[model samples]
Target: MLETRSLTVRFGGQAAVDGVTCAFHRGTLTAIVGPNGAGKTTYFNLISGQLRATAGDVFLSGARITTLPASRRARRGLGRAFQLTNLFPDLSVLENVRLAVQAQAGIGLDFLGLAARHTALHDRAMAVLERVNLASRAAVPAAALSHGDQRKLEVAILLAMQPRIFMFDEPTAGMSVDEVPVILDLIEAIRQDRDRTILLVEHKMDVVRRLADRVIVLHQGRLAADGAPEDVVASAVVQEAYLGVRAGDV
Candidate 1:
């Protein structure tokens, strides 16, 4: 579980994320949705340690982690998939994931062993790949995969970390509509694991409506709505401030 209290992220005098409080509970899928510049990603960045909060606290399972470095935060059961693809194109899919598993296993110093010799890491990496439906492409160089496949590979790489909390910023951003389903399905599978908390920041209403157990709407860097998907979707403030259309009209 993760919680942010009065989290504020400012650049100079301008606040990208205003004081806001929210929580992502274990085994649940929570979505942060809003129009462009609503500070959705900014808030996520603060919670995930990509940016330090100007004011407020971030807690994971009741421990304050606001001051922890990104690497330490990640090592403490947090994982993220960036809106932009981050992958080692020159490496094989299996190798990419192997590196992640190796890092998570605290074997980054063990360069003496051939990566292939780490059978346990290899097996676990393959298992994560299988979870994302990328098992068959494990041996292929990451550069050869399609964009959607590459995104799935990114997810697989993050999965290799065995994180307890996952933050996905626009996980389906560049994919075709058809390609979106695969990522959506993969997200659903991960959510059902009942051991991780997922925070999804996405613009696709269809995906949000389908996957979000709870939805929080942000408008102009503030919380505009927070509740069950259906409730938030129908709230007057959410429609007026963000969606610009009543739920029934849409």
Candidate 2:
């Protein structure tokens, strides 16, 4: 459903994301794993339009979207949740998600014609909030929520958009142990939908193992390994270079 052909980006003489050519199909969750600075996030930036690639192309479904800006790509069905929470601090949590639903439905911010749809939007936003366990905090300003809640809110917004392709960059990065399960479970549920595709950048091997149908490893800005999670995780190069462990140990 998505693909990157020779996708690359350079910072001066260093290639942050080398020529990476890969395709992702519907009904699969692919976990991107590598050590710090392996260009996992850089690769994501290239695909999500955060960083324009130095060369190559990004294709959504079948057409090239390399020239499209991030917002356009999003409108074309690419949903991204960054490592940092992206929110409107001044807006209430419900408003934030409501706006996302509004966008997905192609409604303008102008609420003049929104009377008939307001109830529907609110119901959809509340449903997403409830899914993320944030319904009780619906009226709280986004900035007032805790860090974990903020991350969950981001996920809620992503869910509201209902993008065809989901990209999560370290979704559980700063959450407490008690809060991690919610996001993971949510992702697992999304995985069950065969029409959708998911790309996750997670450091937790256990999480990758549990949720990913496939795993791809990046090393020094290049695609080093791609295969079933178990095979890639146990490969000699991944065990030695990426994980800093021997094959036997892994």
Q: Which predicted model would earn the best TM-score? A: 2
The Cα local distance difference test for each model comes to 0.87, 0.92
Q: What is candidate 1's TM-score against the reference?
A: 0.92
- Estimate the lDDT of model 1: 0.87
Candidate 2 overall lDDT versus native:
0.92
Q: What are the runs in model 1 whose C-alpha is more than 4 Å off?
A: 245-250
- Which 10 consecutive residues of model 2 have the lowest summed lDDT? 241-250
lDDT by residue (1-24, candidate 2, tens digit) is 999999989999899999999999
Error of 1 at 92 (Å): 2.0
Clashing pairs in 2: none
